[model samples]
Target chain A: MVDEHADPTVGELSEGAILRSILDRLGASNALVGPGDDAAVIAAADGRVVATVDTLVHGPDFRLAWTSAYDLGYKAAAVNLADVAAMGATPTALLVALAMPDSTRLSFVTGIADGLRAACRELAPGCRVEGGDLTVSDTLTVAVTALGALAGRTPVLRSGARPGDVVAVAGELGRAARGLRVLFERFTDAAHLPVPVDESVLAPAERDDLAAQLRPAPPVALGPVACDEGATAMMDVSDGLLLDASRMAAASGVCIALETAALGDDPRSALTGGEDHALLATFPHDRPLPAGFRRIGRVRAQGPDPVLVDGARYEGRAGWDPYRDWDARTG
Target chain B: MVDEHADPTVGELSEGAILRSILDRLGASNALVGPGDDAAVIAAADGRVVATVDTLVHGPDFRLAWTSAYDLGYKAAAVNLADVAAMGATPTALLVALAMPDSTRLSFVTGIADGLRAACRELAPGCRVEGGDLTVSDTLTVAVTALGALAGRTPVLRSGARPGDVVAVAGELGRAARGLRVLFERFTDAAHLPVPVDESVLAPAERDDLAAQLRPAPPVALGPVACDEGATAMMDVSDGLLLDASRMAAASGVCIALETAALGDDPRSALTGGEDHALLATFPHDRPLPAGFRRIGRVRAQGPDPVLVDGARYEGRAGWDPYRDWDARTG
Candidate 1:
């Protein structure tokens, strides 16, 4: 058991002292260059390195009352690893930077690390928490950078879509969006709910959707598979399908015609709801669709602007804009 | 020329809108992958990646009275790039995460970018600012991650020192310490001043000493050269030389004997002053010394602890401890 007195406030310990204590606890295995160095160097077997970063701020991005430090760690790592996966890379290491009030509990920090390790094991095996910096601040904020390897395959970029290319997606969509809706809109309803409650109370779909939003399971290997199978333009569906599709179209200088009617049940939810983390890629029409992916659209000779529902323009608000007052809209 | 308007507060523009405007002004070279994507991809050649991250908060790290947003950006970039250089790597890219009050002026944000670009050019030419996230918070904070390449040379580690190794250092020391002293202390007497001033007012040595502290010149090339010349153990002088030397001793399980008499004038300052960003390395006595480096000490087998002049343990405070009472000691 750990000593209770060891949990000194961050302000009470020097940066070097705190780092020494943490390093002592984390025995050597995954670490190549541990803390106290300028930058931790981890092993990158394949020639190419994959990387991504994310920052979470208090209140705007997350509320301390609603989420624990552990959840924050898990979510931050998850999001960045998902990005590496989107690039057809396998995560190998992470660098974390955290700022919080001096009075924060050591237990809270340990819990955060636990969550980070758990997510690392689930999403990218062999990934390790290599290094990080901790500082005292007025509010809690976390920034994470994840690095990975491309495993000798060409990277999947978002500017390769051409006319006569088919668009497809891997992994489930709309669940995370539904989860956010349930959590924010129906908080009171979920407050009194017990674990494994009656499915009818929340509806099976709604419960699944809420769970998905809270903890998204990104298709970590689909990106590499898509690239190997000759994906042209590729991206992750993060800010809703329509907005992302438009980005691919703009980058590739071509038109994308998404078949909304063929999207199958809850198409609108998948179209504009965000946080799906599904791989969306375009392939030449002559190439067969890879296993486990569904064809949903096609590239067109028409210029630039993306079209949906049989060549009609999508005039609705495409997705959530954090800086704007959000109001639901549909085309 | 850019448009000059009464700067709109960040609150006035949506996050997407702010990003779009910034991207428009920066043009294409600023990005490999810009904002609005899952994660920004950057070009990392030489088959190895070097990364470092740091976070700066409003109160603990800086005060708005002493630092402008532009200075904040420059300082933040400087610190991270220093880490990359310390690793014997050439910095290539950066990702910034900023959190500020909604009322921050757009002009301030642009100024911050200009500072970042300016510093990048000085430290690592062609270093691109690839991607980042911006959000609203109560107090301002900036987190930056810098990436670099090792150019195929082995990284200098801190565990290779042997009894016969010669300790050498590149670049000046104690300048930042004196600068901090001048900033915090108001001593009027010429002799009592931490930094030297005009020759008519003070000794020549003091003026040069204080100047070193204000603007540190890290010897970036020294790291790679040391590694190439087979440096036994190496590290950047972040903490005072004594404290860092003790660390190298502990890591290598050997004692270090320093000839303070050999260190160019003001040996005490060289021993305890910090933020030099100088590369300190150990090499076999027979090996040719690298240019721009001076021999300062030697690795020894006799002492139990890191020893200074006359084979005595260094008792004077040699480094900054964030948790310690700086006022009580220095005052």
Candidate 2:
């Protein structure tokens, strides 16, 4: 039962009251026109803006039992920021659309707002929530749209990779999936009451894995650097490396060859793991590799298989396909 | 009860397959980079972009039984378009984030996509769905983010109204709310099986009201016209004229005095009905009202009441507050 002295539920508060709480946490606006207007006016200095949207829905994306409000907000912002960065742009602003059950606590809402600000400050500095919409729903959902400025740099597309390009990646790979495994192994017990995760007992490495799962910090700063370094093709590694690489290969009408030896201890996990938000990019073999990126593979002419591991076709699970995997569950 | 051949559920298909079906219906993209990229690159002429987001959740916003997928999509896009237009900008692109239950039919998904495209074609030409994300959820949600181009014009703000300014409005003021009433009176019944509305027997005016509720076509084009005509302050009338006008009044530190005689047949409904998305604007007293707008009231120095009707303070409900009104229900 809710304590009478405790903070009231969002159902008991006005939308304006909740909005004021969030705005207070978001700090100041850097756009031409910020919140409180019909719409926000943002400066697109180069006359062009890069935009992308991503949504995190309850159950399918995360379980409240395993995630905190702050982590949820952080993950939501980080995921969308990764998308904008994948386009070789620096995020200028974020528009968040939050829908939750009215029973959600006012403190929980503020926690999320604080998390949104914290993510922007830590991951994509200078990029903050510019405007958003809040509504009540049966299921909790966070939909974020990120806008970025290319600053006159030509966008790096997945279809731009050519033969003889060196394949590389920036940011961690497989760690998030490992974190997911830890959650499934240690935290997904039916016996435990629903509560925020306690990672104190886990080993240091396992704690790191959990952090990767809950709050991913992708290499956002390296996106523009990769573009400036003449990267030919790039994309966010959301679904496994094997699956996403094949997409880039298919888009470019080329083939990507991976070196399992380079994949830190668990090659299989690195190849098939998902949700790392790593930047997968292809650069010219002649130029020096960018500072944050590590060479892991190479680009070749079109082949029967879009991706090959150490010369042979890598088989088994290609990666996470939301529809297919989700179907497997409910079926 | 399930038809073997009626359409496969979204759970039975891959995300890519569902995406392909929707993409087939969404025509083409006019942006620099469109769907298929991590992010879309849209041209924001004159170095400024207008951005906004709005969400329609299943229960609070629309019911599948009462609203067709097409109408839901159209209304979703239209509402966001009005927000952008209220800033005196021409919408250039939309990014839609849709989350639905796994049991949702492919046909329904495609219908919503068709509706989204139809709204763009009819309401704001040259604007299209450039990118979006689709996911699974227990509750259906549609979140749309619209981007617009200012074209070197200064945006009309709600805080710019002066005491001598004349208040004017473009488009229907209370039609959508009337349609909502019709829905509650006839549609929200315990016996109704959720079905697309059949308004075959309604009178023509009632039909128009229903259309306004289901698929609102707000005066989007008039926003730029008002801007060019030197509207001192402006906003969209989503939450009724009284509430929205008071918002404009409070932001400008003025009092809005509305005349009932100017509000057509049902002045009460016109004053308090919501969801019309009408453009409420103020212009200098010396300038002639724009062609599409009708004079509604005048602005005055700040008074005890932010809004005055016929020189007296409004006594009844000021307007719809999602929080307060919603609490009255669940309580």
Model 2 lDDT per residue over B1-331, tens place: 6474678888888888999999999997899998998999999979989999999998788888789899999999999999999999999999999999888999899999999999999999999999999998889999999999989999999999999899999999889889987887676546543445669867899899999999999899999999999999999999999999999999999999999999999898899998989999999999999999999999999999999999999999877877667532521
Q: What is the lDDT of residue B203 in candidate 1?
A: 53
- Runs off by more than 4 Å, candidate 1: A1-7, A14-17, A20-36, A43-46, A188-207, A262-265, A307-310, A325-331, B1-4, B14-17, B20-46, B186-216, B261-269, B307-310, B322-331
Write down the TM-score of every candidate: 0.84, 0.97
CAPRI rating of model 2: high
Clash count of each predicted structure: 7, 0
Candidate 2 positional error at B35, Å: 0.4
Candidates, DockQ: 0.42, 0.86
TM-score of chain B of each: 0.81, 0.96
Candidate 2 chain B least-lDDT 10 residues: B322-331
Segments of candidate 2 deviating more than 4 angstroms: A1-6, A191-195, A327-331, B1-6, B190-196, B327-331
Candidate 2 lDDT tens digits, A1-331:
7574577788888888999989999999989999999999999999999999999998878888898899999999999899889889999999999999888898888889988899999989989999999998889999999999999999889999999999999998999999988887787556533345678879999999889989999989889999999999999999989999999999999999999988889888899999989999999999999999999999999999999999999869989987777642521
Model 1 chain B worst lDDT window (10 residues) = B322-331
